[model samples]
Target chain A: MSIKNFILFLFLTAILWVVTIFGQSNNPTLMSQWIFDAYNKKEQTAKKIKGKKVIVVAGSNALFGIDSKILSSYFKLPVVNDGVNAGIYLPLILEISKRIINKGDIVLAPLEPNMYSYNHKVGVQVIDYLFARKPLFFWDLSFKEQFYILWHIEFERIWKGYNYRGGSPLTAGFYGAFNIDQNGDQINTSLKFKNQGMFKDLERHHKNPEHYGAEFSTEALGWDYLEKFVSWCNKRDVKVIFVPATLMKHPSYFNDPIEKEFYDKKIIDEVKKRGWTFIGKPHNYMYDSSFYFNTNFHLTQKGKIMRTRQLIKDLKSSLKK
Target chain B: MLFNTYQFIFIFLIPTVIIYLSIPREFKIKFLILVSTIFYSLWSVEHLLILLSSIIINYFLARKLENSILNQRFLLFAIISLNLLPLIYYKYSLFLTFSESSPILPLAISFFTFQQIAFQFDIYKKKQQVKSFEEYLFFILFFPQLVAGPIVHYKELIPQTKEKNWGEYQKDYFNMGIILFSIGLFKKVVLADNLAPIANYAFANIETISNYDAWLGIFAYTFQIYFDFSGYSDMAIGLALFFGIKLPINFNSPYKARNIIEFWRNWHITLSNFLRDHIYIPLGGNRVTLPKQAINILITMAIGGIWHGSGWTFIIWGILHGLILIISHRFNWFKIPSPIAIFLTFFSVLLLWVIFRADNLSDALSYYTILFNFQAIPINIEFNEILLLSCSIIIFFLPNSLSISQYLKAKPKLHWYHSLFVAILFFIALKTLALAPAQTFVYFNF
Candidate 1:
């Protein structure tokens, strides 16, 4: 083959690659589509609610952790849990929350610790979610971010998405869109108190309390976007209350008081400085491992009730002040 | 710094190739040596120093062996020992002492050390000579084949450095290199890496895995090691072709061989040849009594095994192969039907690979027990079944990379479809690389 022909071959391949990226971008997978459907349902619910509603926003921790119906009854107002997968980009989550939150609404953010320290780089999950829920949002991204997404998109995911037979969100069972209630809280009975062996192993492995929690950085990419979200809420006269995500109460945290104090101080100081109404201490929300469903963050059905009662108590105290 | 990485391809290879091709022909070899040094340094400057020191010491000692007459045999032994010193210190000291900690093994120490020893041996035997310091350096330090090699000899590579009319063949070589490299990259990133998870999961969960899962893991590894090593070898040869240098084909569909001897002949051919010439032949290969020859084979194979790693499993894997080779030699297995013979040989190899892949003898034994325990438990582990099937089909029915390269070489004219096929292969491999962390070639540890 001539050098010219070789270059031509390379040119042809580059064209095919670009074509593939565009082609795959339009076709989202069943999992992402299901997540998108849940988002749409939650957005509709938030829109339906009238006057002084409560909007619970975070990652999956908030979805499984909060009892929005109980909170709605307690506050004498509609409550919408707008939390989804934490793996989604933090900024994108905040942006999604921005659309649902209204004037005079209270925003309860019990975000996962890791969310505060998220690196701004685009990951596969973020690409999948954005492509499914709001592809136009992808165009709004910087060229570097888009390139990062396209580069990291696996052939397996694309192939699976292409070959995926159309299925209802119910096919996803426990974590399906169907499991999410009218207020966007995940309420599957099967996930009530199932013993997760993996969490046991995780607990054993993370005996040192030092391994837990994110290293709080005020200048983190997450914090910058979070500040923007708070500003957006503040502009609309929407009250923002920052609370810690529900955590497993490991004994090591009690043993290592210094590490515990450091962990609490970093987050509390940041939240206070940001002018968000910081509610209940993180340690107060740390329940026994039995309260956790699978991961350390997610709560079981009974655990969610306990967490909601605690949140209500914390809110009552703050609102009274 | 691995051939499979984006940084190696984009930063190191492309720039180096552009500079190399544009340079004057007389300066090309020197330029390659410099780039090769840079490549090694990128891996570790300390290791590069170790490599350079080895080259200098071996080169001077080789010259001494070539010139000195009175104590020639003593000097040759001394040179060989001196060459083995660093390899032993870095690679085998922990094994020798049964200790927990040891100095880091320099990358490709086994490969370059063996190459240097062979060159020294060749010089002593008057079969080869180092014409120039630059030529010798370029031969040993040539980047593509330096780390994981086909173990290029002084004769195969050094003479190629002197060739000047490579400009005429530049396009053909580059095209062929691309095709070969694309195939290799696909095998590595797509096949081997994808299969790695299944094998790793099963091995890591050996105590809990069923008979079916155990077999799946073993088969996954059986094909994984072949694809990983052969893929690396193909990439090396393909990369070398870009520079108009042809490294020897290290693999030739060894799975198709009907016997252990033929398997060895086809698998890692350079290493097998090196063992035969340097170790086996020097130990009175086939010229002695049958028992003595058997002992020779055992000793040679054990060394070959240990050369791969300092682990007892590697040594045992080698000794088992040596025993199998002895049995293969003593009996006329040729009388057996060819299909059955191939199956038997493949089965034996598959079993041996367990020993090779295992971290320890105990794990290997437990794995064997699991394979034969006949426990019919449901398969709990999730793996790419389609990929495993595809790998099997490719291994059994598809033409190996050498055959494909040879076929490409023989073709009179290249067509558009051929380019498209190569392009698609390259594109898929590149995207796969983008999706995951590039896995290290399995043989690099050796």
Candidate 2:
């Protein structure tokens, strides 16, 4: 390169470095609400916690008000919400391994059965959880885990997931991402069950029924990483609950088995056999199919209220236990 | 990856440049081609199959036709058809099935297909020789120009493939890689994305829009499509130049054309040339009677219009342009000075573009009704966005490429520091894409 060109390259490189470092904080259009809410809460948690027992209800759409943000308000505890939009199994594992997930946090990590293949929802959310999470983060991952990350990036949309609409906001940017850190009284609303996105959700789910697994057993959810996740949680000293939130009140195509009946039953038996608190039910919070987001397993607004009410009511006794 | 993405600009382009700059002259073309293909195919491997098939069919057939005598012309038709099959499949299928449902994979199948068709023609006419399949395929799928194109010919790109020279590595790398990329990036991320909202809002709810909004939307889209398409072309050309290959320029301030004929020649010049050479001339050119020639122009443009997309609006767009071209050809309204003629041509094309950019025929009618109906709906001007929209219009009308092309030919004497200054400005412009997600080149779907 010419001396002039040399100067130019230097200038551009400098600009990029400066921007990435400073400008990433106020990034608008962080489309997935739960992920944004998590980032909001994570930033908040980083400010609040020293060595707090943060019981996180982390999963795709499982953060915000329903999990740590709201649950903390109910219990008067400080919990870190590692909730991300479409937060599946591997990313959660990677996040936990990276120390974005803290230890001694009573994990209500929802056993999302669909995160079998590492994929979709713009791997940036995955990157944000994995790499964007503050470090003290463990550095090592198994070859399969590392390969899954790369493989996920490569085959994310094509074979991995069913998100073809390309990051259209199916829920409000304000799906209750409010955080109240003022005084002892607190309020934050992140409803995982929202129903307003009925048409969009249905269209998307119909296009790619990611719920169905490669091997069929009448389960709509792709149980790719469920077993591994359960096993992973079993080893840790974390107080865990395997709560499978379903809008399906009974047997149906939309609300799958609590884990194929056999698998979910065995896992529940194992968790109980191991003395961990495992509280869940088959189609426990089931509603009409209309209550769920038109497609996939997300809940709509009205659905969120009903589901959240039922969940908080059910989990209240468990909290006391 | 999108030209706008941080991944492409930072992750992909930066490393590619470093690798491209370090490579030996002989290895550079192969190395760059391989990397560019991988980058291009990151979205899906299926596209590669389509690309490879087109190249294979074209390459072997070109070789066969070159050596054979019996039924050579027919053989040429078969070869061209085979190459175009995927282009037809991917590009036209959705349009063809607009009433029904159809599937689409992200691929710039038309561009490669059209380029190879050009190559096939060049071979048969003894204008260009049949080369190795690798060289032919590389020309067809030269990553920069692969999707949206200047529709490069084999003659220009083939020589670069054979000749391994790296004398201008730095100059080409910085200028093409950094400078051209920055310009293209600015056009896309900053301009097109900015214009997108206004254009989208206007088109979706055209009937509800004011006359001012309609006009603004019409012109905004005109600029948006130009910048979006031409920006992609520049990016493609820039990418090719990094590997020491030059591709043709596709746009030439099309808004400055004096007549529809000149406008087509200037705008999407390759497509115009293809229609004129393949469709127009073969149909009897201007060699027939005047009215017949006018009909020929109409038919040619209709096909060309439909070539842009499969929708009725595209068909109408072609017909409108075809009518304009015929009217211009017959009337001598273009006999005025270059500026006036250019003005007339651009205004007509811009009006036609309203149809081209519309969601459908009814949407086009609604937009045009709102645009020319003179009934002003209450205009809510997002002043900053409106200003950007108008600025894009002014810049779109600015004849940058012809001047740039001329300047390049002249090889003007310039201080090294001036080049340095341009590089800095380029970086500032390209900075806009820093936060933007990777957006596919708009024409890539075609």
Candidate 3:
């Protein structure tokens, strides 16, 4: 067969397979089960909380970042710290940052510093936000970048859930509302985790959340590209608050002043400068070791509860003002 | 831009091909050079600088080496050092930074450093010389083997840069690319990626898993590395052919080899050749005494391990392979048939992959403890686990490593039936692209 005919056949076969696969009545692949859980987990956590005030913490592997139930109960506001550790390539933060806005909404974004600078991470999110959120805008990007964005559809699944596990039916990605209890504290460290590299990262966070801190990773003028977002929010009067959530660990002394300056002067200082309510307390290290899920960076039930109560009070006044 | 990514295959590869084929052949080399730099820059803008610097420094020095009045050895060493300096800077700099003492690492340092060192060796020997910058640039930057390589010899590639015959190019070039790309896609997307989770889970938590799981994890990693590296080599060779260049075939069914000697010949063929030619031959190869020969192989392989990564695990892996070679030479152990030797080599190599895949030496030791001390081998594999295992096994055991055109020489009759079968398989591979494209070419890091 001619090369043209060969290519044509392959293209047809691809289209046919995609059609058949998508056409099949399978509820969802093993991956989506996690997303469904994340979305539902956030909704259910919010729905269960008794108050109108809410804190929406969004990111990749929402389970990895913080415990959900403990924060919810303490705040009276539904607490959904559904942040996956997926790099910025995922549009979850960018997308959720736009959609789930409200008058009393408190948005907390805590991620690794390396994540922000990656082309793939930021690109993935930008691409998805461009196409899925607003299609006409995707064209403005260079064709290659837009083209790359088109392929990363799982930003939805990756951003919102524990998609990595592909676990059993009831707990596809939601490992039961971040099981914050005594027994859960004793995690199964027996499984020799390949994530020793990650442990090193946590060690960095543990020693000093300041140096190699995620806050330093954020841009100085992050009300950036938010000029459009800010104006849009102003017209809608969706009182927006940007809270750089504390990971409950105090940064160590080794954390240089350069990094500390970047966080204090750039991230936290900039967020406050933007007039968004900032929540900072219960430094990550002071809490008991068990209050952490994996490392010092994330909060355990005690840390989450303490922070959430402070958030409720902070948001009440911010909203009132 | 990752060789393992679908975005590279579908978005970059396809469009680049369409553009190349549409353009005249005179512009093809330049087009490819442009595409290759673009492909490289996707990793980091910083990485591209290293690539361009390698191209410029070598191109100028190579010409001077060909024409200069200076003693060739000193110039050769200078040029070789110049080539390797960037690699040391990019790849080892971080190591140096963190160790607060070691050297900096160059991006794709292993590839370019070894490549330029080979080029310098060739120049010293007067084996090949290029008069034109364009040919030199193409030799350095040819996309197929650029980032990851089957390490095309300058002699083979520079001549092809001069050829602009569109008719021959149209006939075989793209056919080779499609088959190679599809196979590579299958290796990366379907095979390497699928096995990764099991390999990752097993290797990571080696302490927690039973002895049976440890073995399972090691074997999974072994196959993952093979399919990942060999698969990349295949893609590199296939893509080289598309540009009407034939890079030396890097993998030749290494898993099927009966002994360590044969396995090295089959795995990363060019690197082996480089080590043999430069390191081994210089150190008296097999012409020396048995003990000296053993030292040569051990030293060569250990450095080979260090060449793979800065980590000790890689060095140990190299040392293990070298020791296997020496012992096999000395006692002539595993005096078995070809089939059994092949399996044993594969199994032993698979066992060693535990070290290669582990987070560090301690994890490797813990895994080894479980694997060796286990009471029984487990037969049970969960469905996803089994799927990955079976896929990894199939990727390894499969005989047809070469894409059709590599073996076929002239286009064997492009039968419609074969074409149709190829079509069905290609998109089946395509559908798997979105399943967490974490399938990086294991060799890329090396």
Candidate 4:
């Protein structure tokens, strides 16, 4: 172990590290399956709805629950579902929504409670890494997040190599895959959910299950971004509507009914104060447990149709004024 | 600034090592003391005052004991009580009170206090030399072993301080240090962190844990703690070596031991040594009648357990181990097969860790109830269950960091192939670290 050998070892280590960092594909599609699925046909979804009068922006709740075609036919306006996964943060959701939103376009955005907390920043980056294809999207990540992505890519390349993959099977398992339809709604509902629980069991289980809501220390950054997005839309004469997330109407669903009431009122007041439209109360969108595909807001086909009909009725009455 | 962090390795360690190696020998100790103080103060500025106060107090007390001819016994008692004060207030305040909140325990309070207490006991018994304040501070605040420790002896460290030469970083020493650090970083990031999710999920939902999940949870924690502490010890030793100093090996593959006594010698060896020297022997050790010796063993181990954390679970864990050790000691008259002995020893230790990891006494009991109950449900553990099993099996056969270092040769005189292997090891460790957030070393809680 002479000085020369020690120096040589260090030199080799540095070279390897640099090479690994630079060797990654600039296109996230070439790196991970989750990222590829997210980016694939994403631009097509956005481009297809250009100049559309109405756009629905959200995460998995909108993707899984909204029936844009039904809404379009009823309102006689082209409606686009711009929802992806719930993992996307409010900032990127606003960024993506603005891309397709034009003058006089009505933007309906409902945020899932899970994405309202401080930890949601990581969730957003995870979604961006797995899906966002643009080079700019990668740069949007914090340095720590970028480092995490680079490290994971290198880890997979070196250790997992050909078998390198990342993602949760729950999303994939429910959607049959991560594919989205041309309308930008998740379509592969051939997911095999073993009905281990009957309706009563599901109801009992979901009863009082810990949920993300006002109790979650809200991220001020998310709310601030939302306000800015709304103000921007207002300047362009593009109407922005803040809508409540869909929920299962089970007694067990609202562990703190008073908290839910307070959260909804606070959210409505905040949205209205920003010169935007506030939709129905949080509990207005509640449906039976049988209507839900699985956890929280993801709706079955019948449930979606029922929800869409209710939303159309509510919108017609509200817009008439 | 955990050892596994990029900040510690690249920002703190690399720069410190470079600067230290470039400095004159006379200024090296001063630089290290300053750097160690900075590293510690990052955790909290208030805690720094606490650490410095403890150091100053112990320093004066040790010196006084050396100089005093009368009332030495009283001073010894006073010093021991004073040392225990901060540890008890910070660590056990909530347990002592019915209150929900407690003071934040200062990092390394348990470790340094124990080290200082042992130093005081040794000096009073005329077994140790009373050194200057500079040497004493170096012994206590050496950053590598500061937060979590092998419970370093003053004798072990004070001598090593003399061997370090400033501006003369030996190539062999630096290389060995790097190798050990990489191994440690890999174990913490990959093995311990990966296993954490499974253990955490099970523990958090203890009321719903099925038998299968319970066993998996306990098994995950067993390996999690082993690799976590083992990785930390290796990193500490390796970091110490960068300055041409060697640290005593803390772990010796305790899981491979065939009995409780052997397991202790292989596990946290320094603490076992301390307990033996300061507590067991002082309490008449095995020189007394069998019943008295048994009582002494129980008392020593129970104190050892409480030293780990302030909880009934820890006490129970210690009492269980003490009882098992007594049984093992008494039963050694009959020879057992190696495989059976290993399984028994490992299984007993694994069961005991459930108590160590559980939140409370009832939780530990519930875990055992579920574990022994054969009426088990088909609990689908939502984690990499296979990896947990595989890693646990691998621990039995793996050549630990110390043995791996030995195989590389004392000088670590590398052939081209050996150098390549070590380099690959370093890359894997770096890649793994990038995969997850830095996990605090498990023993840091102690």
TM-score winner between candidates 1 and 2: 1
Off by over 4 Å in 3: A22-321, B68-70, B89-104, B164-169, B330-335, B377-379, B392-397, B403-411, B437-439
* Candidate 3: residue B144 Cα off by (Å): 1.6
Best by DockQ: 1
TM-score, candidate number 2: 0.64
Deviation from native of the Cα of residue A266 in model 2, angstroms: 16
- In order, the TM-score of chain B in each prediction is 0.97, 0.90, 0.91, 0.95
Clashes of each: 0, 22, 36, 2
For B1-446, candidate 4 gives per-residue lDDT tens digits of 79888898889999999899888888877888899999999999999999999999999889899889999999999999999988998998888884578888899999999899999998998889787888888888889999998788888888866763533877667878877887887778778888888888778888897777787888889999988999899889999989777789999889989899999999999989988888899899989999999999999999899989989998888888999989988998238888788889999999999899999989888888988976656645434776686686668877878788887765435676556666666666776776567778888888
Better of 2 and 3 by lDDT: 3
**Interface RMSD (Å) of candidate 3:** 3.2
| I-RMSD for candidate 4 | 3.2
Give the worst 10-residue stretch by lDDT in candidate 1 chain B. B376-385
Candidate 1 reaches a DockQ of 0.46
Candidate 4, residues A96-197: lDDT per residue as tens digits? 667677888888876775544434235424533433244456566556555555555544443333233443323444442355666666664422442554
Candidate 2 chain B worst ten-residue window by lDDT = B428-437
Q: Show the lowest summed lDDT stretch of 10 residues, model 4 chain A.
A: A161-170
lDDT of each: 0.83, 0.60, 0.61, 0.75
lDDT of 2 by residue, B1-446 (tens): 67667677679877987787777766766776697689768867886766776667678888898988889899888887887666666667767664355556556666677777888888889898886665665676666777677877778777765654542464644454545555676677667776777778888887588887787777777777887887777676677667667777788877777677777878888878888887899899999999889889889989888777778998888888888888877788646988778677778878888888887888887777777778645656665356565665556555474465455446655356545645654554454443445556557655
Candidate 4, pairs of clashing residues: A35-A130, A207-A252
CAPRI quality level assigned to candidate 3 from its DockQ score: acceptable
lDDT of 1 by residue, B169-209 (tens): 47778888888888899899889998999899899998998
User: In model 4, which runs have C-alpha deviations exceeding 4 angstroms?
Assistant: A1-83, A86-148, A153-321, B96-101, B164-167, B375-383
